[model samples]
Target chain A: MKVTIDDVVLPGDFCEDIIKAGEKSRVILGPGLRKELEKIFITKAGVLRKRAPNTYWVDSYQKRYVPARGENVIGVVIQKAGDSFRVDVGGSCSATLSYLSFEGATKKNRPEVQVGDVIYAKMLVASKDMEPELVCVDSNGKKGRLGVLNDGFVFKCSINLVRKILNPSCPLLNSLKNEWPFELAAGMNGRIWIKANSMRETIAVGNAILGCEYLTSEEIKSMCTNIASILAGHVS
Target chain B: MTTKRPQLPKSVLEMKFMRKTRERIEKELENTQGHDSLYSNIITNEMRHATGNFISESSFIFCEDLLEGRLSYKGMNPEIERLMEQDIKTSDPDGEMQKDVSDEILYKKMEALNKKRKSNDTPNKNPVLKKKKKF
Candidate 1:
C-alpha cells in the first residue's frame, strides 16, 4: 500500500499484513504525515458497538429541557385533550395549547385539532415539570400563525435541525425546493415548531433539512425563503 | 436626592437567584420524571450468568488467583487439566521460524502465535497481558 505523509507519498504494504494476520493492528505515521496519510489509509473500519434503544451510552444525568416562554418550537399532536391536545415537541414532556389561543371570533367555527397534526407554536409557559404552555399570536390578537394545523406530515429529527432552520440561510436547506405551505419556529428550550399540509411534503422538507451535510448561513436563508414562498402559494 | 429603599447585598441576591432556579428545576424534574429513574440499569442476558450466592472461602481464593494470572489449567482441577492436553502442541525449533521481527512487522509473529499451541513440556504463556505481582 502507498501512504502519503504531508505531500510526500511513501510506498509500503500496510493493510495486506494486518488483514492476513487477522488481529487488531495499528500503523504509526508521525505528526508530519498523520493528516495526509489519514486521507489515504483505506483499510481501517470504524469500530462501533451496537446498543439497545432507551439505553444511555454515556452519563445518565444530562437532560434536554422542554420549551419555555418566549422560545419558538415545533410540535406534533399525539393525542387530544379537553379543549386542547397533547403534543410532542422534542423534549420529554409534550406541550399543550387551549382552543382559546386560536385567532378569529366565530363561536360556531372552533377549529378542530386532531392527532398527527403538526403545528408551529410559541412557548408561553414552562412550569418546572408541568406541560409546556404554548401560544400563537397575530397582530390583531386574532389567530395569525396560531390556529388549526392542516396539510402536512409529522416528522421527527434531532433538535439540531430546529436550530439550523431558525437562523435561515443554512446551506442544507437551499439545495431543494418543493414550494410547501408551512410555518416553523424553534423553542429556546429545544423544541421545534412546524405547521404544514400533507404528511408527505412535511417529511420531505424535514428530511432535506436533516440530510444537509454542508450548512452555511446563506444556504439556510435560501431554504427558509423557499419554504416561505411555497407557503405563500407563490411556488408549488 | 430623596429617600431611597435599601438594596439586597450581592451575596443575598445570588442566594435568592440560586434558590429560585433550584426550585424551578426541581419542579420540572418532578413533573417529567427523569428517564433513568423510570428504567432499570441492569442488562439481563441469558448467555452470561451473574452469580450472587455465597461460596466457600477457599473457592473464592481459587477464583481470585485465576483472575490474578497466578492460576491456569495447571493450577485448577486435574480433570480440566486432562482435557486441555489435546489443545496443546509440543514446540519445535525447526518448525517454521518467523521471518520478520520488527515492531512494524508484528503481523508475522501474531500469525505464528495463533497457529501453535502449548503441549505438556514447556510452560504455556498467556497471550493476554498479565498484571505484575506487587513487590
Candidate 2:
C-alpha cells in the first residue's frame, strides 16, 4: 500500500512522494527507507516522516542500535585489548576504541579507560565490512563532551524516545530543564546516561523522561509541572 | 567517469605556471593507461559500478538535526553547561547575523567566483586562458 507523510507504513509499502522526488534529484534514504532497481520501498513498520529538502525516513519504534558514522553514542568499555578497548554500544558487535583516539593520548601516556566504564563517544567508522570504531576526540583532538561518563546511571529506552527528547521542538527537555539541575547523555544506540545531585532528583528526572515517551507535548508540560511541584513540596 | 582522461588545453599546458601540474597529469594518465591495459581482462564492468547514487543513513540524528546528547542544564555540571552555552552561542542566529562581511558583499564576491568556475567547466569554449583582473 502507498503511504503518505505521517501515515503508518509497513514493509514493502512505498511512498509516492519519495519516488516522485527521487526522479528529480538525489534523495536521502534514511533508516527504514530502501532504494530498489526502479522504486523506493519501506523496510520497517513505522510512520513515514519527511524533513525539509528531501530527507525521508520511517520513524519506527526500535530498541536495537545499528551503528552509523558521525553519531554520538554512549557506550560501555567491555574489554581492554593490546592498544584499543572494546566498547559495546548495544549494537550487533562491539566497537573498537583506540587508546590514541582520546584527547592528549600518547604512546607513553595512555588514557585511563578501564573495563565496564561507561563512556560517551562518537562512532568514527561504522562500515558493514569492518568493525565499528569509536573515538573520544574530534578532528582537533578535543574531547568536546565525548569522554568517560562518570557517576551516571545508564538506562535503556527505545531509539525513537531518544530522538524525541533530543528534538529541538520537544517540550520534554525544555519543560523540565529549568525546573531542576541534572545532566543527561543520550546515545543514538538507545542508552541514556543520567546524573543528578540527589537520588530522588535523579529518579525523578529519569521517570519524567521515560514517562513522556508516549505523551503529547501539552501533556508532557503538565507532567513536568506536576513533577516540579511534587519535587518542590507544593504537591503530594 | 570515463577511463579516458581529458587533455588539458594546449594553452594551459604551455604556461610556465602549470608545468608541475602538467607533468603530474601526464604521469597520472600514463600510469593509469598502462594499468588499464594490464588489468583489462581481470576487471569487469560491474566493478566500476559498485558505488551507488543513494546514500543510506541508518541513524535519524543526521536527517533530524538533534542537539548534542551530553548536555547539562541550570549549572548541574558546570563544564558541560559551559560547552552547551558555547554551542548555543555559535549556533545563535544573532551571532550569525554579525558576520565578517554582509551577505550582499559575499554574494557579489561569489558571483565573480562563479564566473571563473564557469570558464573552467567549459574549457573547450575558449582556447586561450585570459588573466583575471584584480580590483
Candidate 3:
C-alpha cells in the first residue's frame, strides 16, 4: 500500500514521500490525498499526480461529481426556495444559491432566475455532511462570467474530460477556438454548456470536445479540422 | 513551549519606572505557562497524533494548471471574451504593456515633430521659452 507520485494509487495507500516533503516545507495535498499521523493516505483509486512546489493529487476517472469548495460548476435551477434557489449540480443533493449572492441582488430585487435555467456558478460551500452551496458572484461582488448560462446546449461528460480540456496544454480548445464563433462554459462537475451561431457549429463544437477526450494533440488537431470541414458541408 | 517572540531586555524589565509594563509582560509569560500546564494532563494520546502537513484539496483546477473553462472566442460572446481578456491581463500584467512602443523611440519621435513644428511656425519666436521647456 506504499506508493509514490505518478503511481497507480488506491485507497489506504500511504505515500511516505509526501509526508517527508511536508515535514521539510509546506506541501499541498490536493484531492484524494489525505494526511494521517505523519503519513499521506490516498482515498481515491487513481494515478497519483503531483504539481510543482509540493502540490499533489490523484487523477481518478469519475462521472459522479462530489462537489468541492471554490470550483466553478454548471447547474440548473430546480426550485425557488424563498431567498435561495435549489440547483441540481449532478451531486447527491441539490446545491443552494442565495438570491443575495448574485451581483446587485437585494431582498427587494432578487435576480430573476427561473426554474430549469442552466447557470454557471462557483461552489461556495461543499461539505460532506451539509448540502453544497453555489454563488453567482466572486469576493468583490462581480459576476465575472459566473451567472446564468443563457440559451446554450448542456452536455454531460466524465469529470476527467473536463480537466483534460481545461488543461493549458490541451490542443482541443486551442485548435477549435478560431475555427468558428462559439462560446463554451465547462463545469468542474462534468457538464459543458456551449453556444454557437448555428446548430451545426454548436454540435460540431460538442462533438469535437467529446471526440478529443481520448485523442493525442496531433489527432485532436486533425479531428477538429475534420469536424469543421464536415460542418461546412465539405466532405473532408 | 518554543516561543518565537523575543524576550525584552532584563535591564528594561527591572527598571522601577517600567513596573506596569514589566508586570504585563511577566503576566503574559506566566499565562502561557499556565495554559500549557492547565491542559497538559487533559491532552490524550489521540489529540497529540501528528496528522502530517498535507492539505487536502478537492478541486482539479489547482492540481492541473487548468485554464478557466468559460470562454468566448471569435466574437461569439463579447461579454465573456471581455472577461477572458481581463483575466489574461491580470495573469500577465506586463504582456500587453510590453507590446507598447519603447519610451526612447517615443521621445525621439516627439522631439523630431517638435523641431518641424518650430521651423514651420515660429522659428525664433520664443527661443528662451523652448530651451526652458526642454529642461
Candidate 4:
C-alpha cells in the first residue's frame, strides 16, 4: 500500500512519496523506514512523520530500547566487568561501558562507579551482531551531563513520550519549570529520572509527565496548572 | 600478446637518482600492467558507475537534533543548570554576539581601524628614523 506523510503505516507498506522525493534529491530514511533496492518499506507500525527538507521517520510507541549510536540513554549498571561495566538499557543485550570512557579516568585512577547505579551515557557503538558500547564522557573529555545519576526516582514510559516531552516545542517543560523546582533526566531508552525537594513534589512531577502522554498541548497546559495548584495545598 | 610498458619521465629518472629507485619505478610499471590483465575479467562496468551517496545509517535517533536530557528547573540542581547554560552558550555564539551589526558596519569598522593603524605607524616610523639618524 502507498503511504504518505503522517499516515498510520504498517510493516511492508511502501512509501511512494519518499521514492518520488529521492529521485529529485537525497532523502533520509530515519528509524523505521528502510530502502531496499529501489523501494522504501516501513519496518515498524507507527505514524510516518516527515521533517522539512527530506527526513522521514516512524513515530512508534515502543518500550524496548534497541540501542542506537549517539543516543543518550539511562541504564542501570548491572555488573562490574574487568575493564568495562555492563549496563542494562532495556535492550536485548546489555551494553558495555569502558572504565576509561569516563571523564579523567586513568589506568591508575578508576571512576567510582558501582553496580545498581543509574547512569546517563551516550551509546558509542550499537550493532546487532555485537554488544552495544557506552561512554560517560564526550569527545571533549567532559562528562557534561552524561555520568552517574545520583538520588533520583527512575520510572519507565514509552519511548514516544520521552521524545514528545523533550521536543523544543513541547510546553510541558516550559510551564512546569516555573511551577516547581525539580531536576529531570529523560533518557531516550524509555526511562526517566526525576529529583525534587520532597516526595510529594517528585511524585507530582512524575504524574504530570506521565499524564501528558495522551493529552493535547492545550490540555497539558491546563493539567499542569491543576497539578501546580494541588501541590500548592489548594483543592480548587 | 605482450604489451609495451609505459615510460617514466626522462627528466626525473635522469636527475641524481639511485639505481634502486629507477628499478623500483620500472618494476611498479610492470606490476601495474600485469595486474590489469589478471583482474580485468572480474572488474565490471557497473562497479565504475557506483556512487558513494548511498549511506546506510543504523541509528534511529538523530544525535545532532536532540538536546541534552539532564536539565534542572529553577535552580533545583545548580550543577546541571550550569552545564545546560554552558551548552547553550557554546552551541549559539551568534545569538550571544552583537546581532545588529551588518556586513557594511563591520567593513566600515575594519576600514576605520586600518586608517588609525596607518596613522600610528607613520608617527612611530618617524621617531624610529630620527633615532636611527642620531645613531
Candidate 5:
C-alpha cells in the first residue's frame, strides 16, 4: 500500500499507514483484505506523479513564527518582576525586557515597564538547549516602542493566526486598514495581544487571525465571529 | 583529521534544543524516503492482526525494526464516537445499541482517565512562586 501526499488521507495518517503497510509486506506480499487496505491507500502512481523534488515535509501543523535569532518581533508584557518584565512572544517561553535595556535609563533602580505593555523587541539569541533572549535596545542603544499597552483587547490566538495578522497582504488588515488604527504585538511564544479602541476594531482584528493550517480571510473572519459570539454568550 | 565537537556555552542551550528536535524529525523523514513499499506494509499487517481493527487516520505510525505494539489510539477517536452516537440516536431512538461499557478493566481505565481530567482541571494552589529568570 503506497501512500502519497494527495492520498485523501491526512499527512500524519498517510505517514502512519505507509509505515504499517510497509512493515507487514516485508516478508510476504499476498492477498490479505484488499478493501480494508484500499480504504487507507490512494495509489502509488498518484504519489509518484505528485512528488516534487523541492517539496518540504512538515508536521501536520504549519510553521508560523517561533522566535529565531536576529528576528525582530512584537511581544506583550505578561508579568513584571524587579528590573525585568516577562513578554509572551508566540512560543512556549516568554521574552524578557529589562529596565536597563530600555532607551534611556539614568539609574539602575528606575521603573521602566509594568505588565500588559505591548512592546517591540529584538531576539538576540535562539537556541535549543537554552531559552530565547530578547533585548529592546537597538544598534544605536535607543529604546523604541516600550511601554504599557493601552486601549486594546488581549486576544489569545494560535501562533499561525498571529502570522496571518502580521502578514502584509492579509485581507483583514486591508479591509480595516484605516478603520482601526491600533498597535499589534504578536508574541513568538504563542500569544497575541491586540490593543484597539472599540470592541468593533478588536473584533475586526480578531476575525483576521487564522491558524489550523491554510484558511482564507473570509473563513477566518467567520470563525472569529462565531468564537466571539460563543465567548460573549458564556460571559453574558 | 578528527574534528572535536565544539563545546557550546550554557547560556545558548535553547538554541541547541530546537536544532536537535528539528534534526531528529528531518532525519526520520529522510530515512523513510528510501525504504521499499514492503517495509511499511509489514508493520501495518502485524498491528492490525494484534488489534483486530484498522488504524485510524490520526494514529502515529512509525516502524523501528520491532513490529511490537507500543501505543495505540483506541479510545482517542472522539470524532468517530460522536458520529456513532448520532447514528445510534437516529436509527434507534430507544437507544438499544448505546449500552455503556461495563467491562471491569475498561471501567477502571475510564475511572482513571476521569480522575486525571479532574485533577488537571483544578488550578495549582500556589500560582505565584518566583523562580530564577532564565534567558
Candidate 6:
C-alpha cells in the first residue's frame, strides 16, 4: 500500500512509496522499517516519518532500552568485573565497559570508575546474542562530551520522551536553557541526569522536561516560561 | 583409446632447452585442473557476480542524527559548557554565520593592511633617523 509520511503504521503494512522513491536514488530505511525481497515492511507500530533526502524512520513509543550500536547511553556502574565494569543501562542485559576504553586509560593507569557512578558512554558493539560493549572515548581517542556524570539526579522516563527532548527541532531545551543555569544529560536508555546550582533549580529543570512530554511545541515553550517564573517565586 | 592431454603454449614450450620453464608450466596446468575438480561444486555462479552493496540491518540509532543530550546554560557546570563550546566549535569550525569572503575582498583587505603597516613603519623610522642625525 502507498502510505504517506506521518501516517500511523503497523506491522505487516507494506509501503510501496519507498520502492518508488528508491527507484530514483538510494533510500535509507531507518529503525522499524526493513527491506524484504522486493517490498518494504514495517516491523513496529508507529508513525512513519521521512526526513529530507530520502531518510525514513518510525517514531514509536517505547520504554525498554534495546541496545543499538553507536548510541550514547547513560549507565550506572553496577559491578567491577576483572577488566571491565558492568553497567546497568535500563536494558534487558547489562553492558560491559572495558577499563581501557576511557580517554588516556592504559594498562598501568586505569580509569577511576566506581560502582553507583553514572557514566554517559557510547555503544561500541551491540548484537542480539552477544553482550553489548561500551566505550567512553570516541574514534579520535578523545572523550568529547561523554564520560562519568557527577552529582546529578538521574531519573527514568519513556524513551519517546528522551527522543522528543533531544530532537534538534524540539523547543523544550531552547526555552529552558535561557531561563535557568542547569546541566542536563539525556541517555537514549530512558534515563536523564540533571544538575543545577541549587536543588530547587534542578527540580525545576526536571519538572519542566517531564511536563513537556505530551505538550506541543508552542505549548512546551509557554510551559517552560511558566515553570521558570514559578521557580523564581513570581506567580505571573 | 587413451585421452590426449592438453598442450601448453607453443611460444613457451619452444624456448631453448628451458627445463625449469617447461616443468613450471606443466605444474601450473596440473594445479589449475586440480582446483577445478576440488571445489567445482562449492563455487556458485551467483558468487562471481555479487554486488558490492550488501545491506546489513541494524537496530541502533545514530547519535549524530539527534541533538546532544547533554547541555548547560549560564555557568552551571562550567566543564560541561566548555565541552559544549568545544563541540560547537568543532562541528562548524568556520561558524554558522561565516561570511563568504571572495578572493577580491581578501586581496583588498591584505592590500589595506599592507598600506597601513607601511605608513606606520615609515613614520617610526623617520623619527629614529631624525634622532640619530641630531646626535
Compute the DockQ of candidate 6: 0.30
lDDT winner, 3 or 4 = 3
DockQ of each: 0.01, 0.50, 0.56, 0.33, 0.01, 0.30
Chain A TM-score of model 6 versus the true structure? Answer: 0.95
Report the C-alpha lDDT of model 3 over A75-172, residue by residue, as the tens digit.
Answer: 99999998889999999999999999999998898898999999999998999999999999999999999999889799999999999999889899
Worst 10 residues of 3 chain A by lDDT: A227-236
Q: In CAPRI terms, where does candidate 4 land?
A: acceptable
Docking class of 3: medium
Per-model TM-score, in order, reads 0.35, 0.76, 0.78, 0.77, 0.39, 0.76
- Superpose all Cα atoms of candidate 3 onto the true structure and report the RMSD in Å to 1 decimal: 8.7
- After superposing candidate 6, which stretches have Cα over 4 Å from the reference? A234-236, B1-64, B93-135
| Top TM-score hit | 3
Write one digit per residue (lDDT tens) for candidate 1, span A1-236: 44221122232213232122222423222111111221312222211111121110110111254444555555777877877778777666788876667665335676566788766666677666677877665446654334444443344544344444433344433333234434343443344334345555555556556554255566655655655556457334
Pairs in steric clash, model 3: none
Residue-level lDDT for A210 in candidate 6: 90
Categorize the docking of model 2: medium
lDDT of 6 by residue, B51-119 (tens): 323233354254126778778888887877888888878988765675699879999999999999998
Q: Write the per-residue lDDT of candidate 4 for residues A60-175, one digit (tens) a residue.
A: 87888898888889999999999999999999999999999999999999999999999999999988899999999989999888999999899999988998888877789989
What digit string (tens of lDDT, one per residue) describes model 5 on residues B15-68? 756778566656865776757564776566645565323322211111011111
- Which candidate number would show the highest lDDT if scored against the true structure? 3
lDDT of 4 at A199: 92
Decreasing TM-score order of the candidates: 3, 4, 2, 6, 5, 1
- Per DockQ, the best of the predicted structures is 3
Lowest summed lDDT across 10 adjacent residues in model 6 chain B is found at: B51-60
Q: Which parts of model 1 are misplaced by more than 4 Å? A: A1-65, A105-109, A138-140, A174-204, A213-236, B1-135
